[model samples]
Target: MPIISVTVGVALLLVLMMVFKLNAFVSLLIVGLFVGVLEGMSPLEAMESVEKGLGGTLGHLTIIIIFGAILGKLMTDSGGAQRIATTLIHSFGEKRVQSAAVITAAIVGIALFFETGVVVLIPLVFTIATAARVPVLYIGMPVIAALITMHGFVPPHPGPTAVASVFGANIGLTMILGIIIAIPAFILGGPVYTKFFKKESLEIEIPKGLFNPKEFKEEELPKFGISLFTALLPVILIALQTIVQIVAPESPIAPVTNFIGDANVALLISVLVAIFTFGLNLGKKMPEIMQSLSEAVSGIALILLIIAAGGAFKQVLIDSHIDKYISDIMAGSTLSPLILTWLIAAILRIAVGSATVAGMTAAGIAAPLVAATGASPELMVLAAGAGSVTFSHVNDAGFWIYKEYFNLTIGQTIKTWSVMVTIISIVGLAGVLILDMFI
Candidate 1:
């Protein structure tokens, strides 16, 4: 029942997950039970703890994740994603493809979940890279970096969303801080990194039956302006809600702010706008649009499950008292809570292979410290988020996705995407720490 033994047990459990290729939910559940038993709970109590942890955590955020997935699917399948990418490319010009790729990924990532954003853009990336005579990694790295940044730091995208929920931080403040850190992370980790790591030009082929680059006949494609608006509507709505809550908390609009600025409502508005701009106005039948939405949702089922399992795993960590133990240890140390959050998240991210899990676990463990120190909860959230996304390796799905999509060998993925994620984590942590000084 020693803390050292408990720490070693948790570490070994994560190793087992990698070695046995165990499902993260099951692995964490087993680990939780073991930790609980070691901490002096009966076996029955340990089992019950798992159930309580999963149920407690999932109750609040599951619906938000499901709705977010559905919205992403709708946007991806209706060609709204394509419209956004094509417009950005034209507006930014070939020389600025890195900037365009980063912006597109960040915007779409905010609208869609991470996996959905990558799947929707992979084909477009191939087409653009071919036309520009550049290495696909030149384009892929920037885009994937942006998606990773948004997925980790932005709201309503599972990682930060779950962190905000766990810590009881203001969702609006989290969203604002997420954006403030995201811009610099994208620039440092995206375009600048892409410039240095540009790879050899190699031809790549899109899979057959995937949407062709030319499928949208010029006449049927929505206007660039309309497509841009559709892509940005949700972000604007959510930002407005956050701004109003912060700047005009006593104003008349504050009472109904949740109704207008709720993440679900904001996304629902975007869905309606997408139906009009990309579906109805484009002459698509309602049935066809509905079909696209259904398929899009189906495509993201695996991702949703992974995220849910991550949530379940996090709940176990909390229930097992592992989080409290770590928080207590950090509280007794000289290290700042901000730095401790980042370090814990970064370590777990490397061990567990999922940024979402790392972020949630770190936040859960760090929440008590934030309370004890009376530090800004917003900064704690940002530090945890940054730490969660610090590194990528063969075990991480995002790393493999980047490797396969860009035809990079493992070494190249390490050099490019892996390094980019590390930079983002460090830069994001620095931003949070600096803000900690002021706040």
Candidate 2:
């Protein structure tokens, strides 16, 4: 009965958001409350759950989200992002530019979260597409594929990070395995799948001035080396932290390393450095830099709100004992733990449209499976991560970002973006399964 009620509540959420054109944030809140009450929580309890969920989610993410936005905005405005794109494009040339996008996105996605990477790279992708005179999907697919793959599979991003914590996965091993899986997933979902889209009509009329490179002289943009370094700082710091802990656990600098390597602190430092390197160092004034930061925050406001609501819905599911429900069912199943973990996460992802929510919620359900099946916790983390990103459609903010950024109609977005993500998901699952056999 509880399972059926949960399913119906999720269905109602979809109907309200899609058919009635209701706001996703409100719909999520409504569904979260409805599900809570259906599961026998008092109305007051449901309300408290929603409030607690919202506060907890936002509290954990607000710093990272805001700082990431600031960094991306400053990078874009100061032409550092453009510098990286231009340098890479010239080096790769028009012929290999699409491949360059995949590599570039992987590098950037390692440092920036998915939303920040997308915002920073959107204009660059369009610029490459226009200059190459190719369909946006040609360049866009590889770029999006790389970003999504990294965001889903890699550490530091919320989904995999939280799942790893829940499942007691080795973060360093998970990162290593994630990169191995991501390579094939990107190739299959991105460049290979792109062949199918190339045959179709791929006309995309971007919004006015969307991809136009800022009016900056050759000397105005940050140098390629510096720009790339700035963008990759977080990854480097985090990597150093991991290395130091492994190599010299009691080193006096461990505390300093931890501080610099903390995700939020890393991003905050990056943003501060960028304000100088991408802004003041390039002659932009304080007010101009502040304006860019303000614009970045405004653009992500809705996305942040939606994520918060998804978190609320996720909390409701956890508090409502769905994890217990799932654990009981899975305990009796004979399926491979890897496949079962992926299935649960994928279903939750489809229902909630938030990868973090899906991964975290599924992690809670699958935690006991780790002990029951004695599966590698790292593989479980990857499996859950893969499922969390399975199919992005109308309910996911990422779907809308791709649709609006590429100026695709609903159908076109599904045909390209949705299909590409599905490919990523399936390939990711396959990669994890294949690795399971050997490892």
> Which candidate achieves the best lDDT against the true structure?
2
Candidate 1 lDDT for residue 308: 51
Leading candidate by TM-score:
1
* Candidate 2 structure quality by residue, lDDT tens digits, 161-268: 656766777665687789889999988988998887544476567677555444778988899998998887766776677778889979999999878877678778
Compared with the true structure, what per-residue lDDT tens digits does model 1 show for residues 289-376?
8887777667655545544555554555566666676667766688888898899889989998888778876775577786666778
Candidate 2: list runs displaced more than 4 Å. 110-137, 154-178, 196-213, 246-252, 318-322, 336-338, 344-384, 393-415, 434-439
- For model 1 the TM-score comes to 0.89
All candidates' TM-scores? 0.89, 0.81
Poorly placed runs, candidate 1 (over 4 Å): 1-6, 198-214, 296-328
lDDT of each: 0.75, 0.79
Each prediction's number of clashing residue pairs:
0, 0
